[model samples]
Target: MTPSAMNMTKEQKEQQDIDDWLPITSSRKAKWWYSAFHNVTALVGAGVLSLPYAMSELGWGPGVAAMILSWVITLYTLWQMVEMHECVPGKRFDRYHELGQHAFGQKLGLWIVVPQQLIVEVGVCIVYMVTGGKSLKKFHDVVAPADAAPIRTSYFIVIFGSAHLLLSQLPNFNSITVVSLAAAVMSLSYSTIAWVASLEHRRHGGSSHVVDYSMTASTSAGRTFNFLSALGDVAFAYAGHNVVLEIQATIPSTPGKPSKKPMWLGVMVAYLVVAVCYLPVAFVGYYVFGNAVDDNILITLEKPRWLIAAANMFVVVHVIGSYQIYAMPVFDMLETFLVKKLRFHPGWPLRLIARSLYVVFTMIVGIAIPFFGGLLGFFGGFAFAPTTYFLPCIMWLIIMKPKKFGFSWCTNWICIIIGVLLSLLAPIGGLRSIIINAKTYKFFS
Candidate 1:
């Protein structure tokens, strides 16, 4: 052992060992493209399938504007987080809460960021659990015989969660780089398939084929709620900021050359890929199916059997990786608490039990309340808006202290204002939709 290691107290040595073994801090060998792959996996996920349904609620003008505005705003917010990762030389904010602690104060920052970050990350895994289930059911139905017996979505959800029982044990983010890369590719692929299939549906149209652009809701209250809910959906689509700092932490930071340069480069490329995946599926899918579009565009498209079936399988695989991407951070938090606060021994047994229980918990909840669209709207607005849209902006303004009324000041305020509005208004619609669905929904079916 080194002289310093020999001199270290038992507690300090144990803490250092934990730091070396923990997932986020364990690796610093990631490349810029790792950022691209992880960002793409996190960004272009289950939210894309719902964009068409969100558009149907929003109609053309607002839908197009919301999509464009969110793209630009989120890209800016992501840049802010990247820059702040190593803002203090010789120190790094390796997790969202760490950055929050720096900005808000130790206790207050953890309070401000942890709950919101947890909601975003844990909420996503729950939603993706539902998504994976739905996607698997869709794939099976497409390939099975016309007379084949139907399967409960709950069963598929359990099956999907089962994958995580194995995968959740993976050590950290860098460990899943290959899976994340494949998911990035799959997200782009399935998104392309959704739009291409949608376009083909339009081109082979009959003279009588109708594509109505009118709002589908019959009541004024319903229309208002749907519009608010659509805003949440758009907000949900740009949800990579919660993990930007963690992803950047994987890339080594040095005094002379900060990690932000390479991280920023990766995100620029990642955002372009996001636009390419998001826009066409949303616009074209809604344009083709109009008010009749299913919340999942893949559910709306039934033709070209082999292709659609393949797309659904891709969704299952993509979410499998996306689930892990979000889950690793949560795992970090859980393990840290257990080891540091609860004083549990830091070893494989603690990790296995903690992670497995978490997987089961989300699985049961997903099966019990599998309202995909409503959950997206609710969680999207409530948690996602703050973290993805405005939390980082708020931190930037606070820490950087840009001049009052200047361009930076004005822009950050604009994003915060919009984010606050979305957070306040959108959940009303989402909760209402859930309640209405629940009146008839039988749990665990």
Candidate 2:
């Protein structure tokens, strides 16, 4: 029950009923670990596997700097978001757009925040759809007999998407906690497997990997494009900020203690786990494979047949959870619109049709063109960079209105400059990479 259970105003009662029905607000009993694994599940995604490839494009200097900077910058912005969640007493901004509506005003905030947030959420779902499918294919190829007829990658993708048909119908954030926890554990497992496997491969005479550290692209233009694309890959990793508010909404908040305390504690633990999973995978995977590292590190380490198979399966599970984490917010937005704006009744039929349709749409899109690296870069720079890195800072400045030119203003401005640059440059490389992949990639292949 809500804190206002004692109240009995007609409109308040009605609003409480809607809140009870909605996905995010329906549960508020999630503990700190819920925040932990949810953040871990959201933060450390399959994108960590691509860090080596991103590092390769960036080379030693920019690569190292980009990795460290993104972790710090996004962490700072994340703290800002957690603080702002209950900044106004007695009210909680349970969703990202709600916070935006408060900071930018109702109408303007929707326009400013919804499109980018939608792109991030929808884009992540599509990317994970592709990832889940690809990992399945990779696993099948490794364990199955070599002479067996090769399955089309498209078929494996459909099989992977089929899982979501049922999973999408899960009621809300609370319902998926077990799934998220499993996914978070699997994420850590596979990331460890990726780096450890990379090291083992290196120990065994490099297993045909090219060990040179020089930029893979020969031409000046090609290297520049890759560098820009790599920025997107790194940006894609620290994307938990996208769903932080929604995750916090699940935790019970009260006047004396507020939700931010437990939420921030969980975030710190999550970030620590992130550093453990990310830094080793990026540095070790790149150290072993150099410029020739594949976009997904697990794909590169194909030796130790059984372990490699297990890692791929882990990836499949992890991305499934990641896909749901990003999708829940979108579901809330859609259902809220249907019930409130369109006057549709809130019921199981609405959730089934709306959520299923959204999942199927992402599945179709993922099946049609699963350019994994390109999607990461494109979505990361275009939307991830903005939402994860600077959108919160922008909101904080607007809402808090700190003294001009003070340390607070300076820090936010610096973050904004970096984030804005990423948004402008990253998509160019990502789009180019997609076009290049398309030339050789038969549709639905």
Candidate 3:
């Protein structure tokens, strides 16, 4: 007898075929909690890195409010996932690029997706490179205490970042899922610890200055501008949900294509989990440091000696995970265009050239923008605004078949309106600060 006929019951043979057809590590194969955790981890990743800096403009109230707004947006995106499953069921669209094409049609889809993908890829890489440099610098300060040049900080970042980016090209969900979970643990552990430790600073009675909301109230323009600019930070914090949709096609099906309810549930739990983790940190960091919190909280805290090295490693680990997550889609896109479509084989020569170029690119950008806080703010505010806020609502209205207008629609429209306002706000706020006050907007500073 053939292997399939001899060893298996009819039901067993059928089930094996179904499992074989399903992609390995697809979203369907992921435990519901795993998907939830994957998304929640990414959501918190951006916010935690950003909260220390956000304290400046919004203070505790507004900064915390801003992150809360991120959660609200998360809720909206979760609702979109429900609608997405309803509209684009089964394997109708395997990637976000395909979703964009289906929603907006080919011409308009390319316009939106190409730039969005590029921005996400480049922004993620830049963040990793910069974060790596900072962590290395921290490490050098601890180990050597005083070194003339400290191993040419930029050189160290280029070397390490290049190696990691190359590793990222070999796509595997199991590896990434593990990393995502690990990132979540580190992010939550440190953020929670940091939040608790911050209480110590507050109990010691740090200086306090209540922001005068009325100061900007005289002209609604400035206050309007401040709130709008703050929205970018909020959008950036909430921007990772779209990533889930890209990975949704990977799940295994028992009988037929799986129901989207599990996926939607995972997305929802992830958002709520992230909200729980981030809100407290934003609240405490603002409350503890007040208006003086550094853009990257790692810079502000003076932790125990033992924890210092761990803290440096924590940042490094976070960036490593982030780089892998962000780079996957970019590599996927390149593969689609080059190997899949163009029929260019994936050869050793091609891999060698790509690795060399990636290294050079990482170094140049890393050295130029040594600071990432402002760069993230700008991208979160401007580049990602359309995708996070504007694109989904527009897609829902124009593409998805409508049954009844629901609360989901209501929330997404609010996101759309907020996103538009922020896109305008980022440039206006940046320019106003510059032209009026002669202050320059710094990318990393």
Candidate 4:
């Protein structure tokens, strides 16, 4: 060992090892805008499409409150993640599992995050496959020959999955920044379209005259269950916390300088964009359609055929971009295990075959289930509540070990309690919703 290395403490040596493993290459490093693009693409996804439906369930006051609460809680956890990364003194825990190991002890860290991260991310890809296929089919129905046999959504799933497979081969996160930027723009594009369409529909008196603005649910049981489900939906909407560290890793840190500034800047800009995109769609769509808003607000729009079609097209594109951004972490994790643990050579052949097989696997699941709302509820409640809410608070408490009964201590404990409640109740509500809707469920329906 080198002289300085030989003299290092155990913690210092361990930190050095991690730093060596995660060297930020010039090509892989990015600027703040690139980070912002990645965060926006990761955060604002197909979940945003459900905001209006969530509003329908919770009404204006409660729905907006839920959305804002989710946003603040998620943003706070994101900051916690950044703080935890700096906890090891000189070492950087650039991956989620690393942070887990640091806070929860060695093997427990990987066990804690790997399965849930896979569920949230792989689940998202499956949702993307289903949503993309449905959007494509809708677009086709609009423009295709009326006499032609209606194409099944599975065909479009394969077509889009193939495209995703191609994009997945782009090697690393920095390489996909352009695609993510396009996705951010597409998110804005489709959201703007939905908002404007809702306004016009309201002005022109297109649908039912009455708009329900009451905070009461349809039934008392519904108020409890539906509100829980709405909270889960809002949680799902902000589920990008799980991947924030991975996104932060792409931005190069200057020597001896705090990286949190650029990281916070990117996060702030991205969340600002998220708030702008989410509020209008939720409010306007709910105002226009009230309790009748469809799970995907775009589906509720009937007139302005071209504009709605354009918006759906944007959804497909944005999800395509989103699928890759989210899946890249899963791909990295799998490939790392294969190469480091199994001794597989780090080469293009392995990457292409492994990633392609993974895509096919998600696509198959998408075809078999093809139930969008159920999967959202399941993943949102079962996976996201813990990953996005529970774990971050726990990690901070563990790492920081703040003074007992202090503000940080109380706040973290409160968050932990909230997260636990969400984990237990949200999934029950989500599963119930899935079961109630199961009788009508069909493959690709």
Better of 1 and 4 by lDDT: 1
Residues 185-286 of candidate 2: C-alpha lDDT, one tens digit per residue = 999999899889888988897856557999989899999999999999999987888899999999999898899999999999999999999999999988
- Against the reference, the lDDT scores of all candidates come to 0.92, 0.91, 0.62, 0.81
- Name the better of 1 and 3 by TM-score: 1
Q: Which of the two candidates, 1 or 3, achieves a greater lDDT against the reference? A: 1
Question: Pairing residues by index, what is the TM-score of model 2?
Answer: 0.97
Q: What is the TM-score of each candidate against the true structure?
A: 0.98, 0.97, 0.80, 0.91
Q: How would you encode candidate 4's per-residue C-alpha lDDT over 411-445 as one tens digit per residue?
A: 88887888788778777767777777777777555
94-131 in candidate 1: lDDT tens per residue?
99999999999999999999999999999999999999
Give the Cα-based TM-score of candidate 3 against the true structure: 0.80
lDDT of 3 by residue, 22-124 (tens): 2222234566666665665666664475565565565556666667676776567556654564364444455666678888789889888778767866676
Q: Candidate 3 — what's its lDDT?
A: 0.62
Higher TM-score: candidate 1 or 2? Answer: 1
lDDT of 2: 0.91
Clashing pairs in 3: 26-250, 26-251, 27-250, 27-251, 28-251, 29-251, 53-295, 371-444
Q: How far is candidate 3 from the true structure (C-alpha RMSD, Å)?
A: 6.6
